[model samples]
Target: MYNKGTIIPGLVIFIVFVTFPLWYNGLNAGTVPKPDLPIGQKECVAPAAEMRDNHMKLLNEWRDAVLREDDRVMVKVGGKEYRKGLQMACMQCHNDKEKFCDSCHTYAAVQPTCWDCHLTPKEAASKKETH
Candidate 1:
């Protein structure tokens, strides 16, 4: 027969080990990403949820349009035509890509390759200031 004293302590240890992450996260969870609206703009090219869910898909489409299709970079969403370039267009509003883009990407565990080919807002500003 199992001893009640040993069994109870073992069960408690097992439960705590299994649920440690839940308690830890609940106590010290990171906040969700919140991008600020660009100056003079009320809304983004697409809806908030749409952008959150499918921005990568949209970027791939844009890349194909520009790199493959030769500058057919117009994306019409929500009755407005947006030129699908990160530096030329999206950066105008989301100036701090590190805070806005990287924060969310980090939270979601996605490693976006944009920074490999693009300058961050801070980098772009410094480059401009030096000239």
Candidate 2:
């Protein structure tokens, strides 16, 4: 049989590295996915489930429509229509991107470059307020 001392240390190291992600996430996990609604807000333009699951997709579509195609049209879902602009529509309710966007993004360990182009209302307001 192989040496138990070497086998145990190697096994322990393997498990630690393998489970590092889980432990790290657990340590950092907190009330991220809680109600990220603005004060006194009722509902989003799209449903919460759709927004949570497919926000990036919708953003990509919006980017393409706005930038590449120049096709700024109304987005209709569930018998409701919204003008397709991140800065115009989304930031209306989700103005606090640090709380809403950063919370979920941090939990999921994804670094979305949404703010690279589209500025949050708070940030824009700060700019306007300062200048």
Query: Candidate 1, which segments miss by more than 4 Å at Cα?
Result: 2-14, 74-82
Per-prediction TM-score to the true structure, in the order listed? 0.71, 0.74
Return the TM-score for candidate 1, rounded to 2 decimals: 0.71
Which one is best on TM-score?
2
**Local distance difference test values of all predictions, in order:** 0.78, 0.78
Lowest lDDT sum, 10 consecutive residues, model 1, at: 72-81
Q: Across residues 1-131, which tens digit of lDDT does each residue of candidate 1 receive?
A: 57999999999999999999987898777787775556665677778889879988987877777879888566554456667788776776778777778777778898988888889889988999999
Residue-by-residue lDDT tens digits, candidate 2, 16-84: 999998878787655646646777656776687897799899888888988899988886634556677
Off by over 4 Å in 2: 21-29, 39-43, 74-82
